[model samples]
Target: MEFSHRDDHNNLSLTRFESMLKTNNVLFFDSNEFENIIQHYLENGKIALAKKAIKMGLQQHPSSTNLRLYKTEICILENDLEKAEEILDELYELEPSNEEIYIQKASILSKKDQHQQAINALMIALEFTEDQDDDADLFSLIGMEYLFLEKYADALSYFEKCLEIDMHDYSALYNIIFCFDYLNKNKEAINFLNNYLDENPYCEVAWHQLGLQFTSLKEWKKALAAFDFAIISDDTFVGAYLEKGKVLEKLKCYNEAIEFYEMTLTLDEPTSFALLRIGHCHEKMGNLDLAVDFYYKTVHEDPLLDKGWIAITKFYNRSKNYQKALYYINKAINIDCENVAYWKLYAVINHRLNFLEEAEVGYKKSLDYGNYELETWISRADILTNLGEYEASIINLMQAAEFYPENAEIEYRLAGLNFMVQQNEKGIFHLKNGVLINQEYQFIIKELFPSITELQAVKNIIAVTEKS
Candidate 1:
């Protein structure tokens, strides 16, 4: 049946079945009609009616293989895997060549989380199926099973087979790209998409995926050309427009980027991501007023979008408006205190405003939330040192050294902290380590440890390490 007429056909079958139900009269229908009626009810989620149709179908066509398979399908739907397996076993012995018997077995095994077993069943189904479309579906199913096993290369191979059988399989195309991305095969993905587009020239999805692969390789002009083709193929492709805007931004065409972003707002619902990008473009072009306006709109449009909140906070922070910056960052933290970046910025803002205690608390919160950036570790150590907690400063820098082993800045700071507490031997050890790693960072002592800059032991270690 043609797709356009399938609903009409199903409706006619449904009407006849419903009429038979109302009149309490037995109606004569071929096994095909009975299967259609059962399938239509099942598709419409009328399970009780589907079961009624199934019972009627079996009574009328007792030996119909397809109708009996529908019974196995219903059992699978109800998650009665044991019964489904038993039915499959009977069908297997009676009609070993029936592909659907194995397909149904795959479904039952999939429901039990036995993905490898499901794959084995689908492989058997593939061997018995002669229809090209049926083969494509089996390959797609096998690809999904491999995905569940996290075997991207195996999934990619099967999904590739799906496209080879039917180039119009968009789901298979997308899965192919997903597998390629997971495997970091961007160059291969580019080559594959280029080959596909040669035969299927107007495939908008292929063009869009090609653009994404080019973007990953930082081939900005190629990415722009691919997105342009995608937009030409389908002007209403909102994702293509958004991605093109990002490429334009990377190329420093801020005005052009803004225009593409605005086009998405007209084409679909106004998205916070588009609004945020528009705000950033304006900020880059020095349109401060327009920038802040769009930033505010972004947050108002989607308060849950943490990026929008951060943009607003950064805008105020850059303008040297500490009070407003603090207010916005506090709101962001209130929304998602678990975000380490938000807490890190909150700490910096509080420190600038001389709220040392609150800065200390914010830095600690950031660290607790998994902020392991070099600056965060260094800044927290600085905050402790300024608060006269020399021992805490030393301990904090010690943890930082584990992540950045042999880092000169960390060693320099450690030396300063040790010397501050009169631990001369430990101080000399770190000082030599710092100087040996990078003598260029020697100015750090003048900036952060000015009092220890002239210590004889510190100078001796620096000189000895420099000579060595």
Candidate 2:
């Protein structure tokens, strides 16, 4: 009821402000009224109208400090930091104890990337802040400055202080969790949050953070319990439901996870993420038809969600329906041409269908788009070898070798390619190094070139290496 009244008042003010604008009667507005009008425009990002309002405001009340302060705010938004600081300095002189001047100074300093100076200004603002509720905001600002400086420990301390003042400060709680994650202090976070929950067991945000911390530690049961408590505290919390589903999925309880994911749909509109997870759970449970249905629903709801398309394509590939896989993957590629995973999948499907040239092109595209997976390089090299372009295959493997110097599979493949080109000495060198580095990878040679293993020289090399 109170919120509705405030909304009605704001609407009435906006209507009067617009009527005055249409008639050029804004001059009739007093200084306070003009300030309100300008603030409404500024808050809504109508910078031109805000400037117009400020002009009229200053013309009517040139001595108004509030109007001048709004001008400083406008200057700051425009990135005219020097002008903003000049006005702020004058405002500070006029209102020496005003907390807002210090906050404006902090904003300018933060924009300049002088985080420590911004923090100092906020500290000064804190001295003038009388409201305990405002102290939570001040602490959050100081925490944000420390975060910008990459001082995760300091940021966590300040965010914890903010949470102490207002336990319901969800943003501060999330920041504290982020800081803990950044520091790899999950165990510490669990202990600290457990202690906090001892006194405030009903803090849904704290319980949610504890669940996330347990998730990071792979303690699925504990994470599930934390999420359950969060849901108990606030049954409408969609985040808790989603996270509970994830923990169930992690535990390989697909049916239970699907129930939780479906619970979210009851509380809110079906999200693409929830739909995708339901599809994945069904897929894992061998309900391919149901999985495909949900996957199609996901894409229909959010056509631009590449994961949905990729999921459908991968399902087809797993079922060995190469043609359908190719068709859907092409659709995904059309949606996001720069996605390396899509290109990689495109290459794999093409390779399965024996479209060697197309597969090579897709592999090149994947690599060009920064696909660094070792399998991508190896698959491309294998295609080149199949085309009997042994020299090209060798060159490709050499680049892969540069990226993964200690990879035994790459070394073995290089040895095979060199042998195909009759580089006997080079083949012997790499073959020796590959077997010595990882003897298990000798199976790759058996799979790729069984006839070569029968060679007496190769057998001698293998025998000697095995003995070593």
Candidate 3:
């Protein structure tokens, strides 16, 4: 159904339904109209209204098999599976040839995670289905049941059956691709889709799936060609445009990528994803001002998009504009306070601006949010040391050493912090271990703690470790 036509019909039906409900009159609707009304309520999650509609429908047409099936559906939705099964059994006796009865029974089984039984039910449904066009739907249902069981090969076989019956069964095609991808048979998927496209050359979905397979193989040029074919098959295929833009970006064709990304905005409303990609491309091309503009646009379009704020913050940080970076990063933290990366960036920016207290708070927040990186701990300790909190710095580095036992940099920093705190024996012990692990890290100590090099004992230790 076209969306506009469906929307207009639904609106008219809903308005009439509402008017009838308000007037409390005998609602004059045929069996099909009542079914549509009940279905609309069910689809919109207005379960109470759906129940009312079903009751009124049954009153108007007590022998409606469709309404009885819908009642069984309502029972299933309420998780009264036993009641639903009873209704399905009664309906089966009444209409032995009804495909909908078996389908509903399969749905109930599926709800209980009895996927094999669901497949059996759908297979029986296939036996009863008189319409050839309904075979595709039945095949797709069986495919889904097999999928639920993680039987990808069986699922793909049934989905392929569906595609054979209905060449326009894009859902079946997608399922086939999914099965192949899950089974790590991308090569087979590519071959299958290629063969399918040869017969159904205008299948945009098949072309899109072929493009995705090529992308998985890292064949950027082939992926682009497939995506182009998909776009040619369906000019308004947004997914093709987005994917083509991604491939262009991967190939470093920024200008062409931007054009495709911009084209999506013309076809549909501006999306944060598209805007963010455009900003990233501009940033890559050294257009900082344009990148910042798009990044701002992205956040304005969707304030909840943390990546937009992060991108803007990173751009300003790269330009050494600490204040602006802090502002944007704080916005990101507000949106997702538990995000570890955001807190880490906040800490780094505050440290750069020499806000020692705020930096330490941010660093602790990062750790609290599960940042296990050795660098985070090391940087936090450095900040503490700069604040004349030598003992605190030693404690932090000790924890860092535990996290990365073989890291020479952490050991060296631990040695320097111990020396600063006048723990000579501990300092010497750590220095020896640091040197033994990676003697090259001695340069870090020299650069970071030049005053420590003046100590004769430290100089002797370094010289002896180097010779050894």
Task: Count clashing residue pairs per candidate.
Answer: 0, 0, 0
Q: Write the per-residue lDDT of candidate 1 for residues 85-149, one digit (tens) a residue.
A: 88789889999999999999999888889999999999999899989999999999999999999
lDDT value, candidate 2, whole model: 0.88
Candidate No. with top TM-score: 2
Query: Which regions in candidate 3 have their CA more than 4 angstroms from the true location?
Result: 1-20, 27-33, 43-46, 60-65, 78-86, 89-99, 367-371, 381-468
- Worst 10-residue lDDT window for candidate 2 reads 1-10
- Model 2 clash count equals 0
lDDT of 3 by residue, 1-468 (tens): 112355876667667877888896776677887788888788778899989889888999999999999999999989999999998898889899898999999999999999999988888899998888899889998999999999999999999998898888888888999999999999999999989988999989999999999999999999999999999999999999999999999999999999999999999999998999999999899998899999999999998888888899999999999999999999898888888889989999999999989999999898888897987898888888778898988888888778899789988888887887788889998898988899989987787777898887799998897678
> Which of 2 and 3 is ahead in lDDT?
3
* Strongest candidate by lDDT: 1
Clashing pairs in 1: none
Candidate 2, 181-248: lDDT as tens digits: 89998999898889888988998888988998889888888999999999999999999999999999
- Residue 103 C-alpha lDDT in model 1: 93
CA lDDT, every model vs. true structure: 0.92, 0.88, 0.89
Native-to-model Cα distance after best TM-score fit, residue 233 in candidate 3, in Å: 2.4
What value does the lDDT take at residue 267 in candidate 2? 99
- Global lDDT of model 3: 0.89
Model 2 misplaced regions, further than 4 Å: 1-13, 389-395, 406-408, 411-468
